[model samples]
Target: MDVLIVDDEPLARERLTRMVDQLDGYRVVGQAGDTASALGAISAQDPDVVLLDVRMPGEDGLSAAHQIGELDDPPAVIFCTAFDQYALDAFGTDAVGYLLKPVRAEQLLEVLEKARRPNKLQRQAKQTEASQSSHNGRSHISARTPRGVELIPLEEVRYFIADQKYVTVHHLKGEHLLDETLKELEEEFGNRFLRTHRSALVSVQHIQAMERNGDGHYQVRLADTEQRPPVSRRHAGALKDLLQKL
Candidate 1:
């Protein structure tokens, strides 16, 4: 199992590194000291399990976990904290487990076993492949805005909104008005990205949860830190089924 250790303290990172080095079937691929650097490492290394600290200088571990969860294939997060009180809330981030600090070798071994399972790797590979294919197919998307020409990577887009002839790209950062029709982008990346509406083609990975609103319309919780998007009636059933399978 490839592993990454994320902790702000040098001593803590070293300790976890030694533990991972001692394990037979696991290897330490990378380590990071802050949320930004940790995210960079996660993108570059793609480790299977991330031994993460709860408290840090800038963004806390929970905040980083939320970012990681947005990725196409997030590594299994195991919170390593000195306190046990955070365990109950950790599940909201989809953490596989939590290990109290001054961690025991036996406990480390047990969680390592859990993290090394084949199913985890299989799912990760599938997501990686899907993301790669989706990215490859999206190179043709170019949008002309008042500022300049913007190149929209299909993977970065969360959804789109149509207004007559133009479609606006809705991403985590902001919106961009693209020249291509929604149907054109949808046709190119249909297998990897799903058209949740006539105007919207949402990346499957960013979808967090689905809910039936008071008016019986379905809505989707996006991986965005700010807000959730509406799942139009046309694609609501399919989105619900997709969420169930995940």
Candidate 2:
């Protein structure tokens, strides 16, 4: 089984790598010092399990785990932290194992075996439970690209336009094609994103103004983007009310 070790400390990562190397079937695929790098590694390497650290700079491991859960086929997470207080929170994320710092080789092997035991049905059940209980939504949206998985921060998103099966994410850097439906995006991010039309969802935080075109159809003008998604008659009233508040 492939394993990725994530920790801010180089020594910690080195320790985990050595332990994983000693295992018969497991090999260290990659190592990361922070959550961002860890996520990028996961996308590129597609490891079977991740030895994640609970606390780190920028986004913590818990938040990272939440985003990982959003992936279609996420690797099993095994949190390795110095503090035991995060045990409950870690388990709440459906983590396969939570190993305390200065992990013993035996404990590591045992948790790795435990991580391999869950079937698809069991994993799905745990994920469903975690989603229902955890009110916090995803901080970033992930899309698979030719290079690998690309993560777009919610703050950078301008709008999402649906065209058939794919939804194009308009963000600050550029656009990315996402394998998701508008309804799913709407349901998950209704508060931050306003449904301008059946085919589009605009970021409320990025709305610059609402205007009518020459044909007298309303459209939303979002900041930092030229694309103006048309406002459907059905959703126009709600958009107007929201614009008033903004």
Candidate 3:
């Protein structure tokens, strides 16, 4: 299996590379010093597994792992860090293993033996399960676009409207169709978004005003767009209460 080692220490990287090279089937494909270089290497090499460090200069490994998970076919991540405190957090991601610094040859081999890339279906299932169980929620939403998988930051999103089986993500750039239900979106992003109607969930941060239209129906106006998603009578009171807090 191809492996990528990410560590700020060159000596540490060399040691891990030597250990991986000693293994019968695994080989070190590349090495990165920081999360930015690591991401670039992953894009260039597409390694089967990544031995990542927890802390670095810029973006930490945990945050990098989240972005890596957004990829359509992400490599298995095996954290190699000195801190044991981040073990629980590491497992929260799609990590296959977690080895401490000064890793033993035996431990590396054992972890590598079990590290295997998950299929697309398995990945999707794991992502769904993780989203359901995670309390902190995600910072970005992923969609499969015609070009490739696009990672849309949640801050850019205006609202999510249910369209039959799919949910349309209306964001600053444009709309992207997602194969998710409004219920799942609500469960994952309830803290950031509010349910304006049965078919729509609007961003609480983007809501500018709530006013009654000519027909005596309530509607919400969001920032950066002219679209006014109707507020259902059942949810209008809750919307008003939330708006008052803002």
* TM-scores vs. true structure, each candidate: 0.53, 0.52, 0.49
lDDT by residue (tens digit), candidate 3, 1-246: 779999998999999999999999788889999988998887666677899999888899999899888753467899999999999999999889999988999999989877844433244445545655775878999988999889899999999987546789999999899977777887687667777666788998999999888988788999998888878554576687777989
Question: Highest TM-score: which candidate?
Answer: 1
Top-lDDT structure, candidate number: 2
- In candidate 3, residue 181 scores what lDDT? 79
lDDT tens readout by residue for model 2, 34-140? 98899888766667789999999999999999988876456889999999999999999968999999999999999999987873335434544555566378999
lDDT for model 2 comes to: 0.84
TM-score of 2: 0.52
Q: Please state the error at residue 202 of candidate 2 in Å.
A: 33
The 10-residue segment with the lowest total lDDT in model 3: 116-125
Q: Which lDDT value does model 3 have at 161?
A: 85
Error of 3 at 184 (Å): 19
Query: Any idea how many clashes model 2 has?
Result: 0
Give candidate 1 misplaced runs (Cα > 4 Å): 124-246
Q: Go through the candidates in order and give the C-alpha RMSD of each one to the true structure.
A: 15.4, 17.0, 17.8
